[model samples]
Target chain A: MSRLSGTGLTLAYDKRVIAEQLSVEIPDGSFTVIIGPNACGKSTLLRALSRLLKPAAGTVLLDGGDVHSLPTRTVARTLGLLPQSSTAPDGITVAELVARGRYPHQGLLRRWSERDEQVVTESMAATGVGDLADRNVDELSGGQRQRVWIAMALAQQTPLLLLDEPTTYLDIAHQIEVLDLCAELHERQGRTLVAVLHDLNHAARYATHLIAMRDGKVARSGPPGEVLTAALVEEVFGLPCRVIDDPETGTPLVVPAARRKTSVQAEV
Target chain B: MSKVMVIRPRAVVIGAGALLAMTAVAVLTLGTGDFPIAPADVVKTLAGQGNAAQTFIINELRLPRVVTAILVGMALAAGGAVFQSITRNPLGSPDILGITSGAGAAALAVVILGGSSTALSLAAITGGIGTALLIQLIGGRRGLQGYRFILIGVGMTAILNGIMGWLLTKGVQMENARALLWLAGSFDGRGWEEALPLLGVLIVTIPILAVVCGPGLRMLEMGDDVAAGLGVPVKRLRNGALLVASLVVACAAAAAGPVNFVALIAPNIARRVTRAPGPNLLPSMAIGALLTVAADWLAMHSGYPLPVGVVTGGLGGAYLVWLLISERKAGRI
Candidate 1:
């Protein structure tokens, strides 16, 4: 089993520090979701773990080896990342965009191979973008575009995958659709998955391992049923809310407290 | 055997056709200059069998000019394609990024300071790299994102153009005429001395671009974070690509004095015509060669006898206006 861990990380962008001495361990073959409010450093942690943003101190370890010290292509072969925002080049076909994921496996003289084509096709098929292979990526809908981007990441064929806010900019149905795809990829493909999601309910429902963060620190890290509580919700989000079992999956569902009637009457 | 080649049939066909057109233009350019040698004589002279007059005309007088035009066009177009790919915008050519103007400014300084042509060429290269570094610094760590890079480049170009104008105003008649002709990017009186520097740069840089950097540009088109995630050394690759692009543009500027609009328009034309998903480096170079050769031919034979840069500049300016309106409509501006 491959291990992905970030230990004693001190993260900063320029002089502004975001996290100090932060450590995280992703459970193998589990779908881990990090949930936090905006500016809480959830995405920043993901970036560090995926080697997008180097930690100021400490290291991200993959299989007990420092990710930064290893050859980038080797690390990339073991891990894949789908960032929060990916802009599709103008007039690029869906197939072409997905094929770019094979960069790590290619070289100046080694070039594209049959294995690359096969993997790209399978990835597109898995993400349900096979039908749109010839269509321009810029012409796709938001949901379709997101799926294509995921397809590109999947084409890397890494054992571990990290996604940042993968469900953002999607409506309720599309959000569920993408989350469902991620769940399927985790459960069926048996790959380790880590994602930073904004919605607590979606994270609770889809995440096998959930990590709730507040102010760049982990508030709780455990199974959703064990970690998600009304008290913790109030503590992290500063919202008075009830945590209950979801009807469909029995995961935690949050319902915020209603406004006081006295305050409304006073307004009147 | 492992599969090592990815072929684009459309680009190949388009490139071949462009090459054929360029060859025809080259023959016409050689045969019609000054004394009017026949096309057969030009071909025979190229094959080392023409009479002294035909040989001298084709080999000495006309061949160098045609070669300079083709090489400069190819270099500019290739550089433009690389810049546009790195920036992920069709408008981000070397001309727009202030590279050509930087080279022109340095070349003008050389001329005004009474330096030799060798000094001018070397200074032009140095100027391009320096200006590109300045733009990169001003654009900050975001590299060429949004309109920031273009805006910074425009500011740099304005400053360089001011210096060039001042230099022109300060020079005497003979020197001013020479400087003015160079600024207008004429192919007249250009010989092997000018062609050699550009040829050497192209020989070294073009292979690096086409074989190694070109493929990585596809990943770059997906944004920096994603490109980094895909195992591309984004900063290193971006910097290297920028350096190569700057050098190529500088060499072209040194050879042909800031030939306007070839770098700006060639890549876009190649992209539209070939419709390739990745960077159209080769096709763009071919298109650039054709456009420059055709423009030079028109410049020589158009009765009014304008500089080659005038035609490209006028046409490119019109295209720029159309592009701005279209981009505005598309909400990209």
Candidate 2:
């Protein structure tokens, strides 16, 4: 069974509705990817699932209990979240940044434990930031900084994880490094993942289940092979496309239609 | 595991060590008066068994002064750190929020109207808290973005200063001299009568500082959305910090008259020394005490009888310039 499910969910900012009558179930241990154009409510839906945003009409349930009513630490213990960017205090080391993920577990009289250290170390190693632990987070490269954030999320030691636009602003190599790490986390660590992604190719390649959203609605939901058709891409994105199987992995590939700027005489 | 456990304990250990150093330096702070005492005799006086003349010099006179310095320092710095955390600004302090301005005017009113000392303290506390509230109302919910609160506070401070200046000019010489009692911030001429009242506030406020402000501060630093998402009651935390900060400044100012900049510089320095976001409160208290004691020593013994506020106020302005230049260099401001 999936750990997080939003039912009959309607989300909006103030009075402007972003997603209406929305419903989704993020499967346990499954890499689920949400892909859509900008302003398509993908991030909003993710926030609703993560309990960061309140749904206007319905509730997000965690294992059959309302997430809002459950203690924040309880939800945090079960589900970890990595926002697009995290702010760190000045001169804060990567290790310290990661250690903050253990805050929900700490208290006034309680002390740090070997288990916390182990979790923090393993998270850093898993995210390939083990060597960068002592370095200041703000001084690191964008890619390295992102890894430090992931290490923080991993340090949370949650069974389910949600990420919003985790690949934004990265070059091709760094993008793959991030996605590949996410893939490793899903494949090896068996952590449930729900990510909002812009790159459909990356989404199809990594996602076990894909949900393509459009104009405040889920346009299609299924395995990538059947749901991610050229027709569906054109309808959802308002762009024409050609679909083909990926050479590296057998998943739908989307190529958008383009217009020639010049006719034959103009080109001449 | 060992490292993590070790660092927290070390912060406390080093904090206590700083406290001890401050106490020893405080001993030097004594004997700064016209008649000096031997260090051993000062210690003997401190232990409550010394010769009569030394006892009168140290216990009857200097001891209360030292305690006053410690109380003012702790009150201002600890209050500043809490306010800065909740507001998420390096510049936030009780004085910057117009608390001191209100206290000054209120204390002036008490003296001009011949209010009792206890009534005077009450009036000052109420006035200080009210002024802080007034600034927050004018500045609104976006406290730090445009320096609106600070600018508004400077205006309030100027108004209060004008009122104090006018009141001083209006009085007869003897009345003016009595009014002047509140003007120069001093540990001079104080006794346990002054220290005792402050002790009550310290006992009530310090535990509240430990239990309430510490955790809520961490949440406040990450912005409202993130803090609220983390389940910190953001509004409550902010308002509580403001309330506590107001009370602290008012009580300290009532006890010692205003001592400037210990609040501003102490927390900033403590944060740097600890390498943490908000100043570690305990260390900040220790540092504040050191700063006040140091300033008092300079005030009493620096070849002239300067008010401690003059030294500290000058220090605060220079620090402001330094912070501005450094921030401009770093491209943060």
Candidate 3:
């Protein structure tokens, strides 16, 4: 059974509606990736599920309780989110930045316990940022900085974690590095992970369950083997593509169809 | 159980040092005026061991001005740190948020109307708070997000400055001089009447801000989405901090008539001294008290007895120019 789910959600910014009555479920202990073309509302759906954006209509359920109805700190203890863009304060060290994730577990009188210190250390180690704890976050490479951010989310120690395009703006190798870390957290730590990704192949490779969106609605959602196909990719992304198994992992790989060479040859 | 609170040694050292320096300056100021009490005698007077005449001079004549200067400095500095953190810009002090301009305009109006000092103080506070509410209503639709709030505040400051100029023109010569003296910001002749109210507000608000809100506000420096994701009620915290900070600024204005640059420069100086990230609220307060007390001492000792505001304004203008150049060199402007 799913622990986090949304029903009949109508998302919008101001007067402009982005989705209407959209429903989704994130399977417990599964690596679920939501993929869609630009402006397809995947990130908005993630925001609503994380309770960063309140839905105009309907409810987001966490463990059968309405998420919006719960105390924000209570919800935060159970769920952590890594937003698409967040700036580290000027001159903040990696450890200091990661320690901020303890906010939900902290209070006015009960700040920075032994457990908090242990968790921050473990989170940094788990993300391979332990050695860089003293380094200024502003001076880190993009890949290292992304790892530090993930460490911060890990420090929250929540069972469920949401990432909004966590791989954007990174190079291909860094993207793979970040995805591998997410996969490791899902596999080794048993975190129920939800990520909105732009790369179809990466989603297919890393995601145990996939949700493909078109316009403002879910086009298909299932295991990648069943949901990712040439026709589905064409329909959802409006791209003519061929789907083949990834040689390394046997997951679906989308290769866009090459354009005809007649017009190019004539121009040349 | 051993509570493992994060503590920076450097900040602690800086805070302690600033407190010591501030006390030294305050004591020296108390001893240096026309009566010329020695520092030892000033300490004795503070300890209630001085003769009646010295006691009267210290308690009745000089102590109130020093206390008011310290309180106003602490208030403005704390307010400045809050604004800078919220806006994530060094220039985002209470002055930039139009608090000083609003208070100045209202006080000018009172001076022109030949109001009593008590009425003038009340008017200044009311005007500052009213401007804050208006700015929040207009620019806070999307929460107190960064550049938009600063831009709106700049616009409000411009409008209020125009009003202040027109009011000055409408006043007679004597009234204009009175208004200008108040505008220049001073602690001359101020007594417990001003210091007590400011102290009361600071006593209630500063602890709450430092203990309850400081960590949450630090989280906000990461951005709204991140802070919210971390379970901070971002809008509520921002609004609450803004209101509390505005009230502090208004009260300081009432006490000292819109002292310039203490709010603008204190937080930055505190940050540099401690070399710590986040708002550095406590350090800012200490540094602010030191800066004001020191400046007031210099003004009192400068032979001609210039207003404290003139000294700060002149020094702050130079500091601002240096700040712009340094920020530009760092490519942060």
Candidate 4:
């Protein structure tokens, strides 16, 4: 499997520096989730790693070569990214949308082939969107639409997939549904999955490799059991919380500590 | 869980059907003029074997006008489709982008300032390109997203219209009247001098457009970030589409004097008719051709002999209003 890593990277947008001298390696065949507070540069780091945002310094390497120096379509054939939000074109069917992911593999003379058809079919089946293949994307519910989007990413047939805040606008149930799908894709297929997630507890529950970020730096990086703790949660999020085992999964679950009233405030 | 990727049959049918309709419309319109000739004679003369009167009517009088309508329809519709798909807004057409108005302003200036047909064509093309480049420089850094680009385009259009109004009022009566007829988009005196150059530009543009529409436009509908991730050279694709669209609009406006609403309405009409998922470039072009030819026929045959632009503007404005109401009802706005 090709290894993906970024070393000694300086990430920036225009003039404002987001992260300086940041280095990280994504472990092979693991569900790696990066968690951070709002504007902590988690998404920025993901963007750099995915080659959506070029680093101000250092290199993003796929295998041994510099990713930026590689042919963009070649890099795309290896790594696929699902952005947070993408609007469906009017009246587009799920199959047609997913078929677009085959673009990187297609050449000018070689348009859609039989293999493209098979891959698209397999991707829809894998994402459990086969039944919705003929349905217009706008008619589907939010969770279904997200799945269709993921199916499109899967249709790219890349081994390494990165998602930036895949569960952002989704409600609790839908969030869990998407995470469950991601976990299944990782564990079943042995593909490297990197996602930037907002909820710490959800990240701990789903991610095999957890990266906790604070102030443009990785505060903790390890397995969920080793890295997630009450003290770390308090330090990272500035919220006093107790970390306990999840009843169903035995992963770390954070419970916020209740605020106590002082004597003067209580009297008033 | 068995599913297959399939091409849309409806779109193919619609495309072929529109082409057939355009052929019929073109032939019919070619035959309906001051000295009316039969459709048989129109085709016979087009094939370079006809009587002297038939040859004169087809070759000298009606052929260029028909050819101009066809080319303008093609350019504006295809250009509109490109703009709409890139901007991801149904209302995002060359007319909305201030391109047509800019061309109109330049063409008017050329008319008043005393220029040849070729000079006027060249100036109009430059003006459209200038306006498009200005829009790109100002609000296009982020790509054509949200209201900013459209708003800026509207402002520019207003300013250009203001300039055009000033030019018309300050100019002499004969020139002003001639400018007004041009602004209303007449095919009354258009000839091979205009049609030949536009055909040359189209010969280059249409193939490039066909090549890009598949991957470039398909990726674009997925949004810029996803498009980039899919290995589409996003900036290059966008710039290419913009250039092609701008050039076509310039060429069409130069030929037909900024005929209103065909660019704005044809792409949307094609989409609705074909029910295609992505950008309907070919279908839109066909629809544009048909709409323009049909409108020209109506304008000439309307007893008072109105300009083609008047008919298109009136019909297209009504269509726009209907679209607004429908979109609002569907909660798209």
Per-prediction fnat: 0.61, 0.10, 0.70, 0.70
The alpha-carbon deviation from the true structure for residue A156 of candidate 1, after best TM-score superposition, in angstroms, is 0.3
Return the candidate ranking by DockQ, descending.
4, 3, 1, 2
lDDT of model number 4: 0.88
Clashes of 2: 0
Q: What TM-score does model 1 achieve against the real structure?
A: 0.96
**lDDT by residue (tens digit), candidate 4, A1-268:** 3399988989999989999888888999889999878888999999999888899999999978788888889988999999976888888889988888898999788888888989998889888898998899989998889989999999998999999988878888999998999999998888999999888899999999999888888898999999999999888888899999999999999999988788899999
Alpha-carbon shift of residue B52 in model 3 (angstroms): 2.8
lDDT of 3 by residue, A41-135 (tens): 99999999999888999899999999988998998899999998798998788999999999999997897778898999999999999999888
Candidate 4 scores a C-alpha RMSD against the true structure in Å of 2.1
The regions of model 1 sitting more than 4 angstroms off are A262-268, B1-5
The candidate that achieves the highest DockQ relative to the unseen native structure: 4
lDDT of 3 by residue, B126-213 (tens): 8888888899899888866667888999899999999999999899999999889899899998999999999999999898788877
lDDT against the true structure, each candidate: 0.89, 0.79, 0.91, 0.88
For each predicted model, how many residue pairs clash, with residues at least 3 apart or on different chains? 0, 0, 0, 0
Q: Could you give candidate 1's per-residue lDDT for residues A1-268 as a string of tens digits? A: 3499988999899888999988889999999999988898999999999998889998999999999888888888899999987888777788888888898888877877788988988899899999998888889999999999999899998989999999989999999999999999998899899999988899999999999988888889999998889999988999899988899999999988887689769899
**Per-candidate interface DockQ score:** 0.55, 0.27, 0.61, 0.64
**Candidate 4 or 1, higher TM-score:** 1
Clash pairs (backbone) in predicted model 4:
none
Candidate 2 segments exceeding 4 Å error: A8-21, A262-268, B1-17, B105-113, B131-184, B219-235, B302-304
Give every collision pair in model 1.
none
Report lDDT (Cα) of residue A225, candidate 3.
95
Using DockQ as the measure, name the better of candidate 3 and candidate 4.
4
